[model samples]
Target: MKRILIIATDGFEQSELEQPKKLLEEAGAETVVASLETGTIKGWEDGDWGSDVQVETTVDKVSADDFDGLLLPGGQINPDVLRLNDTVIDLIKSFDKQDKPIAAICHAPWLLIEAGLVDGKVVTAWPSVRTDLKNAGGDVIDRKVAVDGNLITSRNPDDIPAFTEALIDAVKIPAENVVEHI
Candidate 1:
């Protein structure tokens, strides 16, 4: 079975995290939510504080080697706060270094930029983030889903379906053959 590590924290976009996670589970992939804290993290939905999701583990307690892919759910506050965290950045870098599928949507790409994984990579993110992606040396596009190497990115919650599909496909492929499949 494929194991996917989902990284999120307070203010994560509710649908962005919940929808894809539900879809991934229905697709037969096991997912674990890791956060900066051990309790529940609140989500943001429709301009207000949304539901809470239980945190399965803390980010520092997990390793990239143990998961087939990484899923980063984005909300302006979630990625903004997480990008400032060194441990979170290092974990993202480890996933990239190991050539594992690192799927990030919406503002989540901000974390990718922090991890220094955007250089020369084709990616997409919420409109407000395109400039940052470009500045980080990423080939920013307006597509719903952009797959470069083992990196999978999407523009926003509206793109979650395609985004999740890409991640699942990438997870099912062997590391060495990921690029070819994309």
Candidate 2:
């Protein structure tokens, strides 16, 4: 089975992580959740605290080599806090250097900027972070999803379907092709 890594922390947008994870799993990808610390991480939802997802491992212990793709789920606080961690930034950079798919949504694209992967790339994020993305030399768009080489970005929760599909497409063969052979 293909392995996909999700990097997030407390205050992640509840839907962003949960929805895509569900989609990826249903599509046959094994998903792993990594956070700054082990145990459980709480999510934010509808203007309040939300669900707590069990953390499979801490980011510092896992490596880009172990997974085929990277996912960064965004909420205002989640990416803001993660971007400040040097190890998290370096890990993101490592994934980019390997040319693996890096999918980030909403404010999660901030992590891309901090990792120095945003410059001159096309990306999308929450409205609040578009300026920051532009300032970092990213060509920010207002679409539901944006694909730039190995990077994938989406605007918000409503974009999750396209976002997850794009990520899945990068790491797996298309189902239509399998059906054709069958």
Candidate 3:
């Protein structure tokens, strides 16, 4: 089974993280919630504190080689705080170096910018961050989901369906001579 690493901190968008996690888990992928620290992380739902998701592994304890993909669930405060962490940014860079699938939603793409992985890539994020993303050299769009190379991005919670589907396809694409692009 493929393993996916979800890097998040407190204030993650509840649906963006929980929905895809449920889908990935049902598809038989092992999902690890990697946070800045262990214990429980809070979620943001409809502009309020939602639920809590347990952190399975801290960022310092995770190795990029052990996972098949990375996920970033966004919330206003979630990615804001994450972008300030050097270690978290380094981890994001490590996943990019490995060419592993990395998905970011809502404000989560902020970390992508901080990690220096947005240049020349097509992605979509919460409208509020469009300027920041463009300044970082990314082609920004308003689509529900955008898939470029090994990166998957979505605009918001409403886009979770397409976002989840894109991620599922990312892992399901047979690793062969086949050049199927997502």
Candidate 4:
């Protein structure tokens, strides 16, 4: 099974993380949630704290090689805090270096910009993140989802369905190719 790594922490947008995770599972991909620490991470929803997701592993304990794809869920607080983590930035860079699929939503694109992988790529993120994406040389759009090479980005919570589909498709395409070669 394809394994997708979801790297998040306290204050993740509830739907953006959970919905895609559920959708991915339904599509036959296994997901692992990793954070800076163990235990559960609280989520933000409709302007307040919402549900909590269990962290299956810590970021320091895994690498891009551990999963077929990387998912960066967005929330106002989640990316803001994660962007400051050098280890998180480095892990993202590792995925980019290998051209592994990396899906980010809303403010989560901030981590992509920090990883220096946004330049010259077409992407879409929450309104607040558009400027950072542009400043980093990305071609930002207002669309629900943008797939540029190995990177996938979506605008907001409402775009979760499209975002999830894009990610599932990304993994499926590669898996299909592998099966054909075998």
Candidate 5:
């Protein structure tokens, strides 16, 4: 079975994380949620605190080699904070180094930029993050989903379906065979 590692922390976009996880599982993949700390992490929804998801493990305890892909659900706060952690950045870099699928939506691309994986890559993200991605040398587009090499990115919650589908496809096929966009 394909195993996906979902990394997030307090303030993740509720639907971005939950919907993709549900769809991935339904598509026959196993997902493990890792956070900055133990226990559960809260989500951000509609300008307020939303649901909580259990943290199966901490980021520092996981490795890119153990999972088939990485899922990064974004919220204004989630990626903003996660990007500052060295451990989180290192983990993201590890995934990129292994050429594994790294699916990031909305502001989650901020983490990708921080990990220095955006250069020369085609990607999409929340509008506010487009400038950042461009500044980081990424070919930013306004599509619902964009895939460049092993990096997959989406714009926002509304693009969750396409984003999730892209990730599932990437996981089910060899990296070189994955589609470029959706």
Candidate 6:
């Protein structure tokens, strides 16, 4: 089975992480949650701490080759905390260097900027990060989903369905083709 990695930290937007994880699993991808620390990470919903999602691996223990795709869930605090971790930033850069499909939602794209992967890429993220994206040389958009090369991004939790679909499409072979391989 193809494997996907989700990089998140405490305060990730609840829906942005849960919804896509469900969709990706139903699409036949094995997903692993990687974070700065092990155990669980708390999410943010509305203006407060939300549910907790289990983290299976730490950034220092994961390798880009182990995953066919990467997902970055966004919340102001989530990506902010992640972007400051040097190992986390290196992992992002490693994935980009391998040209693997990567999806970032909401403020998750901030991690991309910190990893120096935003240059010349067309991306969409939370409205608050528009200027930061632009300042980092990204062609910012306000779309529901945006795909540039191997990078995928969505505006907010409302766009999770589309974002998940785009992510599956980017890394998965057509169903007919997959059956043939099987």
Q: What is candidate 6's TM-score against the reference?
A: 0.94
Per-candidate TM-scores read 0.94, 0.95, 0.93, 0.94, 0.94, 0.94
* Candidate 5 lDDT, 90-115, residue by residue in tens: 99999999999999999999999999
Q: Hey, what RMSD does candidate 6 come out at?
A: 3.5
Count of clashes in candidate 4: 0
Report per-prediction Cα RMSD to one decimal. 4.0, 3.1, 3.8, 4.2, 3.4, 3.5
1-182: candidate 6 lDDT, tens digit per residue: 77899999899999989988877877788899999888999999999999999999999999998989899999999999999999988988888999999899999999999999999999999999989999999999999999999999999988988888888888973564331110
Better of 4 and 5 by lDDT: 5
Model 5 misplacement above 4 A: 173-182
Candidate 3, residue 160: Cα displacement in angstroms equals 0.6
RMSD of 3: 3.8
Q: Candidate 3 has what TM-score?
A: 0.93
> Whole-model lDDT, candidate 5?
0.92
Instruction: Give lDDT per model, in order.
Output: 0.93, 0.91, 0.88, 0.91, 0.92, 0.89
Candidate 2 lDDT at 63 equals: 93
lDDT digits (tens) for residues 124-167 of candidate 1: 99999999999999999899899999999999988888898899
Worst 10 residues of 6 by lDDT: 173-182
Models ranked on lDDT: 1, 5, 2, 4, 6, 3
Pairs clashing in candidate 3?
Answer: none
**Local accuracy of candidate 2 as per-residue lDDT tens digits, 1-182:** 87899999999999999988888887778999999999999999999999999999999999999999999999999999999999899999999999999999999999999999999999999999999999999998999889999999999999998888888888874564322110
Residue-level lDDT of model 3, residues 77-152, one tens digit each, is 9999999988889888998999999999999999999998889999999999988999999999999999999989
60 Cα displacement, candidate 1 (Å): 1.0
